[model samples]
Target: MGGNFLQSRSAIRHEVGQYIIRNIFASSGLSLYILVDTVFIAAAGGTFGLAALNISLPVFNFFNSLGLLFGIGGSTIYSINKLKDPKKVETLFGKLLLFCILLGCGFAILLNLFPTQILTILGAEGQTMAVALGYFRIIALGAPLFMCNYVCVNFIRNDGNPQLTMIATLSATLVVVFLDWLLIFVFNLHMLGAAIATLFSPLTSLTVLTFHRKNKQRQLKLKFAFPEPKTLLKAASLGIPSFLTEMSTGVSIFVFNWVLLKLSGNYAVAAYGVIANIAIVVLALSNGIALGVQPIASREYGKRNWENVKTAMKLGIQVAFGLACLLYFILVVFKTPIVSVFNHDHSAKLAQIAVNGLPLYFLSVFFASQNLVIMLSLAAIERAKMAFVLSLLRGYFILIAAVLIFAKFFGVNGVWLSVPFTEACVCALGFYFLTSALKNKN
Candidate 1:
């Protein structure tokens, strides 16, 4: 079990692909539950209910920042372990476990104390505030469980059992969907029921996975002692880029929600919710591909396999771009039909926005997705600062600037256009850095 894994490619490929497929099911199922949950709530309580859930989007994503500590830090260290040592892998994993526990507690405190204030800041309105606040508080109570779900799956993926990771995910999704129907519909629990369902779902999944370690040939060491002084910080620093990139995406959606709310109202927000649910499917598939490549990129780079690194970059981008193009055609060509599925009454402004926004959104999605992959690839190979910078540019700074500048002049339309503009600029920067890095080494 402690031996070299490179020569184990024949077995690894079959295992990894299975793992990717399983995780894909998990992402797909979870996304579907979420879409359905919002739809069910809307039918029960209307757009206020939908907007209430939308308001919590940022907070949910921000919790993901905490989970990423293990995803990037522990996983990267684990992947390169054969080149380093198993003991170091054990230590890193141990330290990350402690990190998740402490951080999850901190988030629980923060979220519990600030539900209404935070929702207000995210642009929840007069009527939306009470509903959003109630829904958020209920959901916030489960932050620890949610964070654990993230850390566990990421660790399992790094543990060389991607399939188990996927199953754990499916278990969570199945449980959540069933419980949501019971809690929300049968019980008339409404937002509270939905929130509780979300909370208990992942908790159940985490519990089910505990039994799988009995067959484990590879052992992950857990240390109860305080991590070596800088280990926590070092691991977190490696994880920060991933943390920030993803969390900032939450901020982007938060902003989009606000703009959409003012521009087209709650109907638009609900329509956007449906559209976002669809996009999550794309994001999920893209993520599965990223997971497959991350460990390979990390390990190969450690061995100075520049050719493989370059090839992986091309292949990764090729797959992502092709997916984006396919989605673009679907949304662009079938805009009315897509919007009609969710609701068609009143000739809603939201339907028009969906039709307009989908095409523009995908224009730079390929670039954005590919750029995200490159960022993760660099990070996996222990190139933290560069990855961090690229993440910053793509996830935050440049896009914010573009959105602010154009949105002021263009109003609602300006906001919609910001995505492609920001993404194209970010991709140029990624290419520049990659080119320069290659030149400098030569």
Candidate 2:
């Protein structure tokens, strides 16, 4: 019995590790689409360009958030039902895909028609408004593509094709990198060039995902089924935590942009732009670990294999913390160089603010990493309400309150500290929820 237990633990670890490695690479590559844009845009357009991109990011986040809402939600359900009811899983893919495409197109039309109003609400003004409009308009055209790609990626990964998903994501990133440089520099398209390049990311990712249909192991079929309101609501309910998780970033950015613009004007917002983009990559790392564990945990839970589910969660938490430590260390030690990479025009003010903010803003990662794993673990075990509550507290309620209170007391430094403070509080809440979930299950 002891020997079997040891072997079981090892097997679970190896399986979890495999998913983690692939997901980390895929998530990191996906994040680079925007990171690359920041770098190239910095070189071509300077601080204003960076600010404009930052202002427009919430829109991008909104697109991705909705996709995850459907993607992760639907995929989690699919994973649970894949073996139990394969036919339901088949219809799920088609229904969600169609709904996402139509929803995305609606957003595209609205954004294109009211670019200025949206940009202004997001804190764009004057030169920033002018620069943002071009990028925003071009990016709006790809809304359907973005939503579809996200939905497909999540479904494919859950369908037991993570390798294909990783390949698709990395390939898309590489293509974006090359095109970002080509369009921004070679064509001197600057902000517009970067936007055009970004459009290809989802296009490339979706194109590559098409090959999943050929995989002999494939189970999901894309047969069109009109989405029933009941089915859509079920998926959305499961996915709300994920939706909030992604939207929290956009919402936080919108609030931060507004506050920062008020406190110190464009340069401060520019400084924040630098720190926020880096945070995207860090959060992506944490999210990768969560996503890696999600499929395994959900499947195990569906099987009622509590021990295996626990094993996956434990491994995820350990990896998340380890990566968090390493990332913070790198950010602390190499802060200058990292800031410089985004500071092409070399403004002293921008560099100073970003350097100071990097360490403080990043302290949140430790808690944020664990929060992600805990939230996803809850969701995996079908604890959607717990996950949703945690998501709301950390991503919105606690964060918004922390930012306002901290900014009042600490000024700019307080703004930076708000994230860490919020995450720490959420970490406590997440632990309570996770404990309650396990106790109830047992």
Candidate 3:
């Protein structure tokens, strides 16, 4: 009996570790879509290009968030119901995929029709406006592809083929990187080339995901079904936290751009572009860790195996903390070189602002990482209200208020401190919710 217990524990750890490692790579690769774009665009068009990219980012975030709304939410529901109600799970992927396609098409049409109006609302103007228009238009056309790719990847991962999801993401990222160079440099397409390369990202990911059908263990099938209102609402409720977590980044960027433009100028916004993109990579890492814990926790929760659920959460928090520490150290030690990569023209103002903001802004990750794990864990166990509350506080309410007040009092440095302060506060609330929920359950 004792040996059996030990073996069970060991098996849990091994399974969780495998998910974490593969997801980190997959998530990081997904982020490179923007990170690599930032690098090449900086080289191609310099400050204006980088600043324009930042201005246009909120739209990209919106597309990705909508995908998560359906993908993560639908997949979480699928995971919980897959074993108990296999027939119900069959139509979920189909319904969610149809929902995303229709929703994505609507966004694409609107964005293409009113590029200038939308970009202006996002704070793009002057030279940045011209650069953003071309880039944003190209990106808009790929919305369906992006949303569908995300939906497919999430369901595939939960369907017991995380390895294929990892392969698809990494491979697509590699293709985009090469295309970024070929289109942006070789073809001299500049910003347009960069946007074109980005379109290839979802295309490649989707193509690779097609191979999932070849898996002998695969259960998910792409059956087309019109979404039912009741089912859509349920999945949306489960996915709202993830959607908000992502949109919060977009909303924060939109707010920050408005504030920074008033506080400093375009240079300040450009500096923020560098810091924010790096922050995206960090958030992706944290999300990867959370994603790894999610399927396991959700599956165990479905089985009513509370002990396994707790164990998975505990392991997730540990991994998040360790990775956060290492990431912060690396960011601080190499701040100058990192900033230089984005500051193509070596503008002193851009350098100084980004260099100073890198460490201050990144200090949030330590808390942010744990918050992500807790939020996702809460969602997995069907404690979505708590997860939504944490997401709102961290991404919307607390963050917006913090940035506004901090910038008013401390200027740009205060702007940098706002995220850390918000994450720290949210972290406290998250622990309270987690402890209360677990205590009640146990």
Candidate 4:
């Protein structure tokens, strides 16, 4: 088995690359879904409506982060130990599902308790607050499904069922689009309609994943196990990078919303929302590739197959950078039309701000995409500290500092350029850490 696996580096990379592409399609589908949803909301509710959606997003992301935490964390461990200790796979899988439920419920309850306060903190006001609260309440109720779906999808992919994961994600995206059209356009439910459309995704995804659990050839099994403290910590630690990566997005939005609120007005926030929606697609492309490379690298690292690990990491990084460059070109070419999609009224100021901001915002993709792949590779190889540091650098430390300094000096332009600056710096650090580690091994 070891010799066959070692000899198949070319085949492995090809196979893994294909697998990663499928995930890209799924993630891209979801990204398009968000963009479509934004269009619908903007058309129906206009600036205030769009801003409301933006306000609620950080809350959604916070809950989603918790799901990713357990899901990615547990899934990584299961991938590493699947062959060595298969029984532990079942235990970890079961425990993670349980944990997702409990934590998701806790979060939902908290959202319910503090709806007004949360909205206020998210920078919602008056009309935006009213619209945002409606979206928030309904979406919060879906927390359990949301969290569990994350666990199911990640585990299914790592269990050699990437196809199923892709199917589920694509199917859910289609459903969301259909529901958004029907509810928002036809029923005229507006913000509530949009929220309902999104709320159904977790259910759709979980239903598809259930088939994998019942499959006879399934590698991940559901088995009851009392959660051990040590095991739970291990899972959280492994998944922290993913958690931070996600939460950082929410944090960025929060910071951007606050800064934009002060610099211009709610219209600026709405315009930023359009740019952020586009960002969803760009980041999703990178995330899909990173997730795709993770299982392959982890399994090889588990076997001490250093050469295969290097090949996989190199291929993944190359794909990441290639996709980033292509995306930036497309964004530049279509900047006006893309901004118009969300601006609806074609407000010149909104269009100009977004068009000006997009190029600068997009430069981050070059570094950010490679950073995600590298960070995930480090996590897969059990370099959790390194991965965590990368997450902090991009997600928190570097990003926050850059945003503060830039936004202070350059206003909104500073806001746009800060992302790329932070990412470029982190990419440099990632290079040093990755190279030094590889040299030490040699």
- Candidate 2 TM-score, true structure as reference: 0.99
- Per-residue accuracy of model 2 over 1-442 as CA lDDT, tens digit each: 9999889888988998899889988887778798999999999889999999999999999999999999999999999999988876779999999999999999999999999998988989999999899999999988889889889999999998899889999999999999999998998999999999999998999999999989999888999889999989999988999999999999999999998988888988999999999999899989999999999999999989888889999999999999999999999999999999999988999998899999999999999999999998899899999999999998899999888889888889999999999999999989898988887885
Model 3, runs deviating above 4 Å: none
lDDT of 3 by residue, 1-442 (tens): 9888778767777788889888888888888889999999999989989899999999999999999888989999999999998898898999999989998999899999999999999999999999899999999999999899889989999999889889999998899999999999999999999999999999999999999999999889889999999989999899999999999999999999999999989999999999999999999999999999999999989998787788888999999999999999999999999999999998999999999999999999999999999999999999999999999999999999999999999999999999999999999999999989888874
- Where is the poorest 10-residue window by lDDT in model 2? 25-34
Error of 4 at 245 (Å): 0.6
State in Å the error of residue 171, model 4: 0.2
Sorted by lDDT, highest first, which candidate order results? 3, 2, 4, 1
Instruction: Please name the candidate that would achieve the greatest lDDT relative to the true structure.
Output: 3
| RMSD versus native structure for model 2 | 0.9
Q: Point out where model 1 deviates above 4 Å.
A: 1-23, 26-32, 344-347, 435-442
**Local error of candidate 2 at 43, Å?**
0.8
Give each model's whole-structure lDDT. 0.69, 0.92, 0.93, 0.86
- Candidate 4 local lDDT, 1-442, one digit each (tens): 8878656987878877987898798667656667777999999888888889888888777777888888888889999999998866768888888877888888888898899998998899999998889889988888888889888888888998888888888888889999999999899898899889997787887888788966667778787667788888999998999899988988999999999999988878988998888887789889999898899988988898887788888988999988988999999999888888788776777788888999989999999999988888888888888889999999899999898899999999999999999999999999888776666653
| Pairs clashing within candidate 2 | none
lDDT for each residue of candidate 1 in 1-442, tens digit (9 for 90 to 100): 4244444444445444554466556555545556656656665556677667777877877776677755667677777774557766666665666667777788788888987787888888788887777778877777777766777667666666666766777777778878888888899988888888888666876886675576465455555555675776776777777787667667777877877777668766766665665665666666666666676667667777665556555566666677677867777798777766655243466567667767766576677766766677667766678878887877688877777787688866677678888878877887777656645543
For each candidate in turn, the TM-score is 0.88, 0.99, 0.99, 0.96
Report the lDDT of model 4 for residue 128. Answer: 93
Q: What is the lDDT of residue 24 in candidate 2?
A: 88
**Which residue segments of model 2 deviate by more than 4 Å?**
none
